[model samples]
Target chain A: MTDGLWVYLAASPLLWLAGTLVVWIAASSVAKFRPGNPFLNPIMLTIAAIAGILCATGIDYGTYFEGAQFIHFLLGPATVALGIPLYEKLSLVKSNLVPMLSALVVGCLAAVGSTVFLSELFGFAPAIVASLAPKSTTAAVAMAISSGLKGDPALTAAVVVFTGICGAVVVTPMMNAMRIKDFSARRTCVPWDWHRACLLRGSRRRIVFRNSYGTECNSNISCCTSVSVSQLDSEHLHVDAERRQAHKRDQGAGCRLSQWKSEPGKHRARTRLDAINGQQPRRRPYRRGPVD
Target chain B: MLNGLAILFTFQLAGEIVAYLLGGWVPGPVVGMAMIAVALTLTRSTSFLNPAHEGTVSTSKTILANLGILFVPAGVGIIQHLDLIRDRGFALLAVVVLSTVATLTLTVWTFILVKRLSGGYGND
Candidate 1:
């Protein structure tokens, strides 16, 4: 090669980055394309396409790796940047922490275990198994795991990238399918029937009470009736959340009407009583204190 | 960019020290992240999340955005492996395709199973 050609060849990294950026810019202009989604992500597609180019040209891996290393540098911080989303969703993480940690552990184990086992059973060689072991985590984490295990980092890196791409793409469809199953299992039904049952029972129960003036009259009848209604209905339509809310509102109005009748002198006092003995606190059994 | 530099330096320092202390079992960044999360919670403040100091984050992204050139070196490795094509080409292809499939399957399955157990009941 001529000296000018040699000088040009040495500047390949700048060309690669510029080319990749151009690809991203083009992909973004496409309406159907989405970043982060494996199917449409420009970065991933570009990476794959570039790899294809190198493979076709029979270029040395060392030279390709040099140009690619700049992109690789960003991987570390991008892995860290995941914390930004994690932080935004921190409340969800904290509130459902047990589930989150449990998910992480279970997900990691199932991922590594199943992949390793199945690959072995299917007769993949040891290098491939070592490479496959860290596919669930981000590329940086996967790279570390592979290196620690003495696996080929390149193969591990490739697997990690592909896994991330698939996750970005397939997660949505998978979730939609699960929701379909959840909805199909518990068909929504109104709670009117349960309230009617409670009302019928209440009608038979004789709800007469002493008025504020000490005269004999029905009092807080609606409240008592609604409570009975909600209880009776809880069994039949447990997942009919909307119906339950509506029933509770109807019950509350009934309670107020009856309460006024029973104690025209002290509606506030009756509310105070309700407040004193209302909802119970929720208990979380697995917290196990700070020591654990 | 400066703010980002601070964040990066902070995490890098924290990660290196913690990882060193821990015998490098896990990564330094992981430790730094945990520490930052803990710190933010204890402070119970969103000031740390302010966009005012986030020029660094934007610039850092820009740097990454302009980073397509780095992969060419690794991509060049295909040159020496051309003979492997005449020999172990099929084996290499099998390894790549199978590994990709296996990785995808494991991630999806685990995420599903975890969500089920956690009662989150969905994917992304």
Candidate 2:
């Protein structure tokens, strides 16, 4: 009787769609417990869990995709929605218009060119190279580009996630090593969403950074560097010390670090971070003090 | 929310149309993104007509905030390509990591150079 019921439900597209959403919600909640840990990525966890279930059940990917495609269809509208953040940051974009545009063009070339060149050097198949080419872009856009290039969209998505995690994990160490004193410049290294994934792990540090320097954080780039710096402090003491030394050279950041320690949460850093990421903060448990 | 979604879809539809005309070299949604940016810029003067108001921004934000999950379905296709991954996994990872680091470094340096040429320094 249970097998019969399972067969009936499995045939319906709603089953997997509903299952994916349920799993996602659960994973996201769990991820909140250890936001600083990169391995605790909600999407990664959800994908693994869903993939594991499918493998265990001996279900084909094609069958699971029938239901999951509903979620996939949303990528188009979401891509269009990206314009909102671009528009909101228009003023800042305008100020650094020349630099931003030039950097964007150069960055796009470097990302694709380096990927292709390196993939060729490694003697990867053409399809794999195409898939890797667009991995630096967000998954939605990258998958689209990959498919257009006659590459595997699935492989592209995996690569994109891998690329994002790599970028997130390396941003602090890299920026510190480069000695990029400009907070705004440092923030430009990683894409916004991936950086947010990295930064979200340490809410309390973000709150401290925000409360101590909220007004100055009016610009998105400013907030990102300070928040990430504060977040990475616990994970990398030596790097944190180097950053503090760099901050000491800048009067504002030097004092703010000291002030951040004593300052209680006057403003909601959650909301600020959300606003920066072009999303409102969801209602979740508020854990005060350091997350680490 | 509905209205905002309509606007987003309309832009995406337009993008799809454009991509079709361009022989699909560029993805439709990217074209749609560009269209939205252009429309936003053109309508900057008119607040009522502007799409960057609260509703659209909120809708987009909500969508983008959870954007990572949207790709899970596609990534699961990895099951079919397990052999490929098993063979090329290490090499693929090295390429991605090196390229990303290169991209970040190149982008940041270019940005700094341009910023310095245009002005003295960015606001700290």
Given candidate 2, what's the lDDT at residue A178? 76
List, residue by residue over A6-113, the lDDT tens digit for candidate 1.
568756877555655565456434412332223443334555666676666555566656656766666455434333333433554444444334334444455566
What overall lDDT, based on C-alpha atoms, would model 1 receive against the true structure?
0.42
Q: Show model 2 residue runs off by greater than 4 Å.
A: A204-292, B44-50, B120-124
- In angstroms, the error of model 1 at A111 is 0.5
Q: Write the per-residue lDDT of candidate 2 for residues B1-124, one digit (tens) a residue.
A: 8767878888899989998998987778777876787788777553534576666766776777677778889988888878887898888888989998898898778878988988837465
Residue A161, candidate 1: Cα error in Å is 2.8
What is candidate 1's lDDT per residue for B1-124, written digit by digit as tens? 7676567556657766977898987766555545544554555433544322455445444543333223223323334444644675455444444544443344334434555777765544
Error of 2 at B73 (Å): 1.1
TM-score of the A-chain for all models: 0.53, 0.71
Q: Fraction of reference contacts reproduced per prediction?
A: 0.14, 0.78
Off by over 4 Å in 1: A1-3, A11-13, A27-38, A168-292, B43-52, B56-124
How high is the DockQ of candidate 2? 0.57
